[model samples]
Target: MASSSTIQVKITAARKKTSLLRSLPLPLTLSFPPSPPPTVRDVKTAIQKAHPSFYTVRQKLSLPDTSKALPDDSAVLFDSAGDAELSVGDLGPQVQWRTVFLVEYAGPLLIHPLVYHLPKLFYGAEIEHSSLQKSVYAMVLLHFIKRELETLFVHRFSHSTMPLFNLFKNSAHYHLLSGVLLAYDVYRPAFSAPAVAGTWRANGTLLTAAWVVWVFAQLSNLSAHLTLRALRPAGTTTRAVPTGYGFSPPFALSTPNYFFELLAWAAVCALSGSPAAGLFFGVSAVQITLWAQKKHAAYKREFGDKYPRGRKVLVPGVF
Candidate 1:
């Protein structure tokens, strides 16, 4: 009688396991020892084990009925037992997740400017002669080339792959903007002509001063990035307050890199002598300032009193 009762209990447990598996959404199934509640990380590991293609770092596990992503992968899955059903979605429609390096992003941004500029320089006779246009071209090329090299050797990414779709998005953004800036500032007759059209002259001292600022800002920005990269070692996610060349307080405004970036773009505006370039700088400045504020808040939250309280968000003493 005891043996018979034990066999029936085993059968019931098997049926319960089968039912739980059936209730789970497609392509996701959890198996655990049942003594301890499984964690979101555990589930992610199981999914990766089963799928082999879904890497834990890249995987964005979410509930089936909502778009809100799980915040903490280490949280207990059973804590939200009622909404325990999970689903896996690709980074984009019809596009499976694919890994891309920072260098890949940098390479295209560097090359695209040259690809657009060289033809214009060779074929467009007016642009070929315009020193102003040539100077603008040189600055743009230098900026992107420096970016590419920095991405390759200096910048350390916390996450390895951005969503594959971002490659298309970012490439289009940089390439299209480059085209517009080049078209308006470098190729256009009204903007590129000397002493006749724009307020600033092609070979004027103001343009020379702008070029100086651009070079200084570029070097300063490179130094800032190197300082940031050094805060954490390779393959670690440690965050530390950045210090060095351009970062001494009260000059240590929030995101000194962004401040330097603004300076560089402002130089481009001066070099181009176009209102369009100024507009571009304005838009970029707003965006970078917003990002800087966010970074500042995050630093405060993470480091508490350890983060410098005197640092401004973007501009020192003003913003």
Candidate 2:
């Protein structure tokens, strides 16, 4: 086996398909160690060292044969042979992935409460919200509050940044698509609008059960987040397979955070019965499922047979 420092790799530039940019330069060679391995960031660093303008954010690395881009985080990329090749695409103007996430969540974080509390401005009258409506607002606000705090403190992002245009698109989804729309639906002048499924307020038994379940689900989701955070330590891009409370039987989703988050949202949906809330829940489920699938595949590739076989993508035994 070649020493870690002696493993050689070819870095090829993946240019834009436009004819004007078709005339690309030749590939560059880099030596990496198999022991430590080369992460997507490491390859980007080498490219930047050789070509100053191709910084990390603007660069996308993938296996030579595949166009699917590698995530630029603690992701350790692929196993390398002495002659393995990586294709690096120039993604153009970029911003930190963290920036985009924070900005996106920030919009709804502020907007949800603003519209809920100030009825005169949005509803155009000094209207009082029903007890049920108030409870819905509390749940939604707390959820995003947890998310905002987690993004700032608990969560560790894999990718450093993304295309600049993504900021605008992502913010709109939170601000308008999910945020403003849901706020309007829940806090509208007609207080009855929120009950899309059924009115939990009318049934004390249902209300108690929903709130209790919602609390547990939120805590479970948080436990999953902390477990995931513990996998990657400080000042390094190291990663490992995750395990803990939420990862065990009965709650054994490959990505437990999303599963728990969905569960929490389900409680909210049940209590409010708002179509907008249900729609948001549906969108979140679909998106989280896709993310969970990717993470599951990544865990398989990174750990080989070491990754647990029992773990399903988003659901425990079903999915």
Candidate 3:
């Protein structure tokens, strides 16, 4: 039955529709309001409601006619007729996106402390930590705590969920490498002594300078976060060109909070003088830089002329 506001969407398994056309599985028919036009996520949510076990993350919704996957935020448009055909490709498993961020950031916060405080667990014996080691403990804990708090309170995610595999993969990056490996390498007894950590360990001038830079970097990062947050109002997924405070014109590297994070890590490298610190900084720089580039490109494509030009992905004046 057709209604004035309700549009019926005929959805089918993408693979089954093409490969098993002869079988002709009955498409799952659903009704959605044309007004405020339902989003791809809304359609997927409805399908999930009907089929409790259906993993929305695994499903790829596409048009039956053209068979192109729809963006999560894209509106499902209807023509003069109130009927539309959509396809779903179920992948496998799903997890909340927020859970992923929390797990990733929480990794360093928990593991770093454990490895630092319980030296016997990893080091195989009682070990006295150096002043630099204590400072590193403070820095690592503080950095990740801020990230956790921000993820909980500051950032508004556009997407509600992600594939479950991201949970394990992302956790490994933070928990295994950044958390356990870095903590062990930095706080281990080998790097604790001045002789091994190098003369830089005793350099008060450099220590003071590094600490100062780290503090400023953290503050600027927070500022950048606030500035970016102002772009999208709470409870809405609407995006706009980032403006105010940390953001600059052209937005290439305008208001680069990630760069500030790297700067703080660089200060950690200066303080700890550990190979692990160097490795962490190097890896973080590369990964974050790539992410920045991708984000910039996405913004450009989304906003077009509205998005300011000339901003590099991460590095100012350099891609």
Candidate 4:
């Protein structure tokens, strides 16, 4: 004669095992026929079929499952298959796939070299324009660049590209390594935060503006990096090499990252607490950005109508 508690425990264990078996869905090894070029109906069916399992698992795992079956929307089915047949790029979605690919990959990678080199290159270099804010920016920018590279490339870089590499070799890798060194100087007080004595009528306002601009620049840079990583083919190398830039189109016109860099410089100027420095770097950064933007525009024009239309040369909407 088992105790009441023992009987209850036995029942509970059996119930739990039953629940696990049902949840496991018997690994449908029946090798169903290969799914055909997915129709809109096919996609809907697939989504529906996966939905119940997804929802059940979600509930078990204490997660929310918000996805629903695809609506009977009016369009050709199968928008963008990764490598499947009759996929949805040219004849499927409203957006062009090649352009999408460029934006997703090339745009982000364009700024990699800049971010890669900033910490190593500009950290302590006296500002070319003699602006204290610009100098601080150069340093802070270096710091941010270093942190970003650590996040994005820590596990991604080849062993040869990680630590000390030949800095004087004049190769792209050399430039990249050099930039990292120069940018690193900004982390020190001698490079980053020595209080430069000066007053601008708009120093406070400008500082605020500069902070905002720098924030946008950082966001834009981060966004580009992510988009590129997402777009890279399945088997490509993940190092911060320049190959990612090659396939990119000027989605926002030309040198869109250049635009953000210019904005960052302007913001640094405003925050410089000195109008003279702010004014100087503001002018320089704007001119340089404009030139770069123009060059990118020319390249896009040469590439023809495939380039995205009506987008600003750099800033997303308002140039």
Best by TM-score: 3
Candidate 1 RMSD to the real structure: 7.6
Model 3 C-alpha lDDT versus the unseen true structure? 0.77
The C-alpha lDDT values of all candidates are 0.62, 0.76, 0.77, 0.38
Tens digit per residue, CA lDDT, model 3, 1-319: 4453666777766774433233333344555444567788888887777665665776788887556779888988666786667777765577888799999999898888788888888888776666677778888898888998888988887777788889999998888778988998987877565544456675677778888999998988998898777878888888888865446743346548987888899999988777878887898788897788788789889989887776666766666
Question: For candidate 1, what is the lDDT?
Answer: 0.62
| Candidates 1 and 3 compared by TM-score, better number | 3
Candidate 2 segments exceeding 4 Å error: 1-13, 17-51, 61-87, 192-200
lDDT of 1 by residue, 162-281 (tens): 666766665554555554544444555554455344455555787789888999999989888988999989978777877766667647775889999889988877676667567667
For model 3, the superposed segments whose C-alpha errors exceed 4 Å read 1-8, 16-24, 28-42, 55-58, 65-68, 72-83, 193-198, 249-255
TM-score of each: 0.73, 0.79, 0.84, 0.34
**TM-score comparison, 2 vs 3, better candidate:** 3
Minimal lDDT window, size 10, model 1? 5-14
lDDT for residue 20 in candidate 1, whole number 0-100:
25
**Per-candidate total of colliding backbone pairs:** 1, 8, 4, 15
How good is model 2 by TM-score? Answer: 0.79
Candidate 3 at residue 312, lDDT?
Answer: 64
| lDDT by residue (tens digit), candidate 4, 38-68 | 2334333332254443221112111113222
Arrange candidates, best TM-score first: 3, 2, 1, 4
Predicted structure 4: lDDT: 0.38
